[model samples]
Target: MHVLIVGAGMSGVGTGVIAAAAGHTVTLVDRRPTVGGLWSPGGHYPLARLQETADTYRFPGHPFPSSVRDLPTAAELAEYVRSHAARGGLTEAHFRLSTDVRALRRVPPEEGGGWTATLVPVGGGGGGKEQLRADWVVVASGRESGPPTPMPPVKGLDSFRGRILSDRDTFGMGADELLAAAGVARPLDTTKAAAVPDAVGSTFNSGGASGDPPPPSPNSVVIVGYGKTAMDLAMTLSDGGATAHVVASRRHWRMPSTFFGFISSLPVLYSRAATVVMPSWAATTPAARALAGSLWPLSLAIRWLIVAIAYVSVLGRRDLTGPVPTAALDWFRQSFCMIPDGFRRRLAARRIVVHAPDGVATVAGPTSVRLTSGVVLPTTALLWCRGAEHRAGLSFLPAADVEALFAAGDGVRLYRHTVHPDVPRLAFVSAYNTFGFGTAVHLQATWLTEVWAGQLVLPPAAAQRAEVARVGAFKRDILSCNREPASVIMDRFYSFFDELCGDLSVEPVRVGGVAGWLRPLSPDWYAGVGAEARRASLGVTV
Candidate 1:
């Protein structure tokens, strides 16, 4: 079996490793010169910006260097992946490096079945575009693009005098070029700047230099977005001694890096406690949805319980993390911040300005921005950290195929965010946002592999479609008032994991009875579960 995996990032490479190990010939294609798509040039650079501990964030078969016991630098992780790909049976021939999968179309059985994908050379070399066909196709192109799909321009953006930067535009430039672009005066001594490895003199990127923003921080930049990237930008700026402001239409939920002071948020996010039925489950049908809104109490209680654990996590800990937040406890339950930095402290100290509910109206001038709340802000760089919509930015698929898959803004019409029942011979890895994404993708790729290899079988198409609808209804019926998308907040990981385990005839990672209930809550706990899944998926000796 020949499998063509797209995007060559963590998701793509992870899938390729497992699939190739299964003895199916696999090809990993990415537009970037390196592995780890989002971390590569196309997305964010200076990979050191991420907050996850490297040991937990990596793929199963590979581990970071022993010296990097804690969080490894971005460059280190990127280097590790390059090494991982080179080490496996996945040789240079297994990769079509620096290539763009321009278009994809399914080959009808009448015309010799399989899928046809068009590839275009992206880098320095000039070569005629080519088409490749494969029995199985995996679109793991996990958001590997520029500045997260440009947002609606601010009213006077074109006339802005100072530099406006995006994630790519900021880190993509060299040290001096970046400083000049952001209109910041260069340090008289070029030693610090010249020695900057990945955006800073120190590879760790600690903002220890004398009153200097790390290489990525723009002087007095205004970031627009409240997601993790926005937090990172703010932290980088604060560390670099730059003034940063955040603009948002609504205040997003913010989580403490540690729920109960010492425990990382990963444990809570992927815990069994979070594996509850969502309110949107009611969205499946009008009649049932009428009662969905009434389930608000249950959702509220769930959110409260999570928050309780958060406060309890830090109950007796030293206040070194930051000032305790007394407001917006609800936001903590909506999303995990994952940033173990002093962002909240910086916010309180006015080092980082947060403009929520007073979103940006547009660029007011070359050196200032105006807000919808009738306030104007002075700044040189306007960094748009806005998020991207998955289906809208999916240009690789033919227009017809995209409409068929993502019509009605319902996102991909895939069951469990993997296989699109309506679309055969295709699967998407890392489509869903979850704390345990790596483990989930591993399971998803295996399910597809087992199904394809005749070791397992998919349910009837109707059953698959019904499952999709059922989940959609669950999301819509979640009896919560948070107004966040119903798709979030619930953890269905074990449900899918168990199903796939049964499909492969492997012992599922079940926390049977009471004691089992407490397990699988910590992020690292998945290591054991993932080991079992990997054992089943790859037939590993472990």
Candidate 2:
């Protein structure tokens, strides 16, 4: 089987590796001159960490190095992936860098039942244009590479005397150029500026002898939106001694990585316990409703007490590994999973004010933002951290294929979140958005590959459609159960893993208490078991 993968970042590279390992000929194409996708410098968040567990985060068949811990930086990840590819004996011939896939069409299959794709390379010493046939095409292009959202036209924005800048331009320029562009004086010396922490130094900085502060315009920076990026920017500014004000459209539910020295222990425990104790049947019962009503206040009280204890213990602690305790897995079950109220209070007290129930109208100027509340904030700069949109380079796909594949209700229609119903041969790997480290992509890719190889057969079309409806309904129920948005990756990771292991009829293994004791070690064992079981179940010769 010949496969074409678009975008060489982690998603693309992972897809290529897995597909090629399955004995399929793979061709990886990307617009960049490199293979790391967003892992490359200038394409990713500078301080981002892998938000999920390490076992779920690692590449297939590669052992994680001993020296690494916590979340790795983008550069480290890039190196890790590059090493994996090299060790696999995958080389330049398997990857076409600086090639852009202009369009996708279904040419009749020359060999068998599957379809073929015509790939057009864009740039680089004029490879001109060549047509290549493939049994499958995987769109692994990442979320961040799409075109930037246009800035809303703000009234009187152009009239501002101060400089304006976009996030992209901020990333592009050197520190000196950035400062000059902002009409701010560059730091004159190392001592004072170095002493002052929390400042994000961009491209412009020159070593100097005399100590002098950069000229201060207005010391206030008004940031729009309050997602993860906004939170990071605000934290950075606060560390740097800048007065940062955040205006949010809605109040966000923040979950700390750890609480009272335990990482996700309490939330994990509560979720599992709820599932075990209150089965779906009982949840809908009238008696259950009465019981829930009577116990609701008590539940809230218990949660608060656990959080209060954890908060008091972590205050003024300096351990960056996190103060959360993980010795007992059930410790995760005791505490509230979201950011403790104590932390929110601390942030509020420190002038990191939240202007929720209101959103930005437009930028009045470099020094002001007009709000929807009819109030104008006097500000120095604006940082927008709104969210991202799913945009596949649609120009490359045929109109019929696009209509069939993309969802009518929400812009993308995925069948079982893998193969397109109309274009069955073209499967997308990393199209779905998850909170952290492309877990869904890896899981979906594995399943798609297995299905294509005839190792795992889907139920009949009628049964498959019914299963999709059931899964979709389950997702909706989970979404309602938790106030947070229904994350495809978070909601489906375990279930997908279970299905891949040929155990869809069984419930997911709950990891709490005794199971929690099994966690740190269990993931590895589970992977091994899953792999062997899948191979055996599919009758694949491995």
Candidate 3:
């Protein structure tokens, strides 16, 4: 089988490696010039680092070099991705870098059933149209693959005169360089704004030059959003000697790096048993459902435990001011983040001001922004970290299938979050965005390759559609906060992996004995998955 995989990020590379191992011809394409999609230095915000430790967020059988830091930075991950691809025998011939997939559609039955992909170089004029055909297509491009979504038009935004920077504009920048580029005074030199080129991209609005001078005080940045990017940006700016004021309408629960001061939360959070109590998209098997039912008390305790940690890390801070709504934990929302270091201490120290349950009513003038609460804050630069708009690239599919790809409320109608019931010979990995996306994609790609290799079979079309509908209903009614068309499964990674493993005819629980329940669920536990999959393909018993 000739497999054409899109995106070239963790999902794309991982999918290609697995498919090739399954004896398929793999070709990977990405719009970015680099191999790592979002993890590439050019693709992410300044100073971005992995939320998962290096050990937990990696491909099967390949580990980050021991010298790499626990939370590898964007550059480090990019380098590691390059090495992983090479080690997996994915050479230059397998990649189409700086390439744009113009269109993808199924070939007519008379012409032999397969997929025809329209490809063009990223920049126009260098290459004419190129046609590539494959027996199967995998849309590994993540839903959130593009730049940060711009904020809605602010009243008086056009008239305001300060520099405006979106998350995208600051890519590959340092704290001081970004501040200087935004026309804000550097920490050491507050009197004069440093020179920077005009806005880097068409989307970035370098707001008109203001007659009013930049703020002399340090910490002149006002960041809009509470996502991980916003938190990390605030800390980075603070470390650069500027105060960062964070503004948001509401707070979201932030998972701590550890329990108390000494315990590591990674192992606990990575296990399937950790989220057994939390309501999830239902288990497909009867036995799994019964086991979940039997663990209701443990689930309740876990919820309380999460709440207690949130208070200790963020909500309980006495020095903080503002009427921020306590983040709802009933459903695991996508915005749930791993709290950064010193976030609580900075909140208590007033270095990072929080103005929550409020919004920017309008840009008051060149040097001030008026909040919905009627509080006017002096601002030298406005940095928007508002999350990106997720899009399922359906223009490539036929119009009829495009409509079929969506369920009620615009949720993607994907069977097992991989293949659509109406679409054949094509699958998507990491299309349903989730926490621990790397880990999720690794397992999903394995399952997908197994199906493509005929080692694992999907249920009948009717049964597949029914399962899709059941999961869609669960999301709309229970996990209402996750409304992305490609639903965000917030902490539901473990259960989702279980579903994929079950389909692959392998044990979902990697460890055994009593320790399996509490021990850290490391990716290493599944290192032998490829061997297991090959055995299954051979019709051999484990």
Candidate 4:
């Protein structure tokens, strides 16, 4: 089978590798000149680091360099991701970078049916246009693909004279350089700024330092969002000498980097045993049924205990409190933030200000922002970290197919978060939002390859749609916060993994006997998953 996988980031590369290993020809395409998606150099904002630890946020077999201790910066992970592709035997011959996939239309049934993709050079180079045909299409181009949702339309925004920047505007710079580029003066005790890398420095500045109008001095920066990006920017800006004021209307529970600043949260949160306490929409597994059916009281006690432990971990940190009370159960359903190291200290020291349950009423003047709470904040740079609007990345599809693929306001209704019940020969990876996304995407790749190769059979379309609707209903009726229509299992990854394994006919539980379940689940445990999948596909008993 010939496979055309769109978006050569982590999802695309992982999918392509699995498909190729399944004895299929795969071509990976992306508009960016490199791989790694959000982790690509210049792809992420300055000073961004992985929210996941180095051990958990990677592909199964490919490990980060020995030197990448703890969480890796965006640049370090990008290099690791690029090497992962090369080591998987994907070279230039299999990639179409700096290219745009304009449209994808299915060939009519009268003729031999397949997918025909229209391609054009990204920057209007010598290549006028091109087309490619593939037996299957995998749109792994993530939902966060297009330009970020523009800043909310607040009153007097146009009249404010100070600089206004989005998360996209600060890509590819060191912390010092980012502060400098934003016209923020460094603290008296700080060291000199490092030279910006040539890749971004050459075209980064449109004015100011290079003979254009000087940028407005950003002495005070008000960041407008409370997601991970907002928290990251708050810490980075505060550490870089600018006072950061965070404005948000709502917030969720944040997991501490470490439990009680001692125990590693990874082993506690990422283990399969942890799923017992998390109420799940997927209650098909034995443990899930046991908890929901016969052991409801036990489950309740354990869940409440988990909530107490998580809540107590951050107790007494007044600066960390949100406008509303957040429970541990809420964290399982909605996406929650992981509190970065030293962030609480920054907030306590008054370097970072939190204005929860408040929004910017207007930009009162060139250097003042009026808040909905009736407070006027002094501001120069207004950094908006509001998350991206989901760009369907399906504009290439016919109108009817597009309508069938997406549910209004909910999200792309994919069965098992991989294939659309109404669509055929098309699958998606990284479509669902979750923690440990790399591991999830890799597993999805393996499962999809087996399914496409006829090694496994999915339920009928009606049944699949019913399951999708069931999960959707669970999210709406039971899950709290209900942030996105696309599923976000949050810390419920273990159950998600189990379901994928059950579908592949492979052992859903990787650990040995009862003792192994206690160990922290690592990506390395599943290193042989693709091989296991291939063997299963060939009907070989292991």
| Evaluation by TM-score, superior candidate among 3 and 4 | 4
Error of 4 at 418 (Å): 0.8
- Model 4 pairs whose backbones collide: 410-485
**Worst ten in a row by lDDT for model 2:** 200-209
Looking at model 1, residue 7 earns an lDDT score of: 73
Deviation from truth (RMSD, Å), model 4: 7.4
Tell me the tens digit of each residue's lDDT in model 2 across 122-189: 54466577676777788788545565445566677676555454544444334344344444343422
Greater-lDDT candidate between 1 and 2:
1
C-alpha local distance difference test of each model: 0.59, 0.51, 0.69, 0.73
Q: Which stretches of candidate 1 lie over 4 Å from their true place?
A: 124-126, 144-147, 171-179, 186-219, 259-265, 268-270, 274-302, 309-333, 362-365, 476-492, 502-507, 511-515, 519-542
Model 4, C-alpha of 308: deviation from truth (Å): 2.2
Candidate 1: tens digits of C-alpha lDDT, residues 189-255: 3332223322111111011112322233346767777667777666556444456677766544455
C-alpha displacement of 526 in model 3, angstroms? 1.8
**lDDT of prediction 3:** 0.69
Task: Provide TM-scores for the models.
Answer: 0.78, 0.72, 0.86, 0.89
What's the CA error at residue 483 for candidate 4, in Å? 3.1
Worst 10 residues of 3 by lDDT: 197-206
Per-residue lDDT of model 3, residues 377-480, tens digit only = 77777889876654435566666666677646545668878898778877888777566666677788877776766667777798888888888876776666
Backbone clashes in model 3: 2
lDDT of 4: 0.73
